[model samples]
Target: MKKIALLVLVLFCGTSNAQKKKKSTTNPIVAVIITKTENLTAEVIKPNFYIFRNENSIKKDTLLLKAFSSSITPTDCVIKKFVTKSTPLYYVSWTEKMNSETKLKKETIVVTNVQIWNPATKMQVFSNTQTSTNIKEQVFLDKNKTASETQERNRNEGYNFTLLPTGDFTLKNKAVESKYNLNTVTMKYELPQKSADVSKSSKKKKK
Candidate 1:
């Protein structure tokens, strides 16, 4: 009788551990892509943006798993195998460029892209891109033309985009979350600065 009790207790403990592990592993993970730029003045804002999106300064990396929680389970049983259910995974990405290039070519504007994925379903839930523009006002520049007026007149704008995946997915009986944490690989690089225009280049050559 004692041996039977011991076996039952061990089974119960194993089940509990398995459930805990499953819950912890089911949280979604995020991935990110970042980009940055330098010396983005009003005269060269477009060029800077082009450079940011271009090969050099663009960076891509997986997001660090911050905080996540698994779905609620309200039942307890010994030796009851709980098949893993599909869960949405969130991916966050961002980029930073000179927000107010003309205002402060030295500053940066940050942009982010987020996506939701579910391996169990083999589908994406949602995807979105967000941009944070850090507009810095220069009192010196404001003296010539009011900062507010310049900001209003300037056509430079900030925006965000989002999308939801369409289609259906099926879950399998073998679906199980791995306890081993996953990691994101990051790629960091710098954008290439544009060279002087023909007129400027010719002047340097003449000098």
Candidate 2:
């Protein structure tokens, strides 16, 4: 009876330890959704999106959308299916003004509107808009270069581009933060390498 009692106590302690370990390892789940639209363009622009949980990358996907004559409709805008655990950060980078003339030096304006929604309640919790503008100058001035050579030169030089702001949330109201525990979640955003466009082309070649 003494031996049996000792054995049972040992098993209970082991089980309690295991339960504690499991609880420590558990992480919170986060879903990342990305949507894109061009102001005035005929071609469909499929952009690449990335998600990171803490400092580690969790998911990478291409945002593919149906071709629209002028602008993307509400139904055709969003690309979601990425789900991750722990704290999540999301970002997307794409070339804008695909149809614009690169030879002409002009100012390019990019407007980004961001909205964060509560998945459980299906309500928007935060919204913000940012606009970035840059003047694009003629990079390759060699007229003797062939069309393909000019294209190659243009490809090597990163052209008109816009980077969407990283997905991070901060609750303005103390009550909301306390109720949701959103303050515990942290997000970090990093700019893509300058060779991102070249990498994009490489991916296309592989596909």
Off by over 4 Å in 1: 1-85, 88-100, 103-107, 120-122, 139-207
What is the RMSD, in Å, between candidate 1 and the native fold over all Cα? Answer: 22.8
Residue range 104-137, candidate 2, lDDT tens digits: 4655554444433333333334334444555555
Candidate 1's TM-score = 0.24
Q: Which stretches of candidate 2 lie over 4 Å from their true place?
A: 1-105, 136-207
Q: Each model's C-alpha lDDT?
A: 0.33, 0.37
Please provide, for model 1 over 1-207, each residue's C-alpha lDDT reduced to its tens digit, 9 standing for 90 to 100.
999999999999999999999999894543221222231111112112111112343332222212212321111111111111223343323333333355333344444544333333434444434445544444445555644332322222333432223222211123321111112221111111232254467788999
lDDT of 2: 0.37
Sequence-dependent TM-score of model 2: 0.24
Clashes of each: 12, 0
TM-score of each: 0.24, 0.24
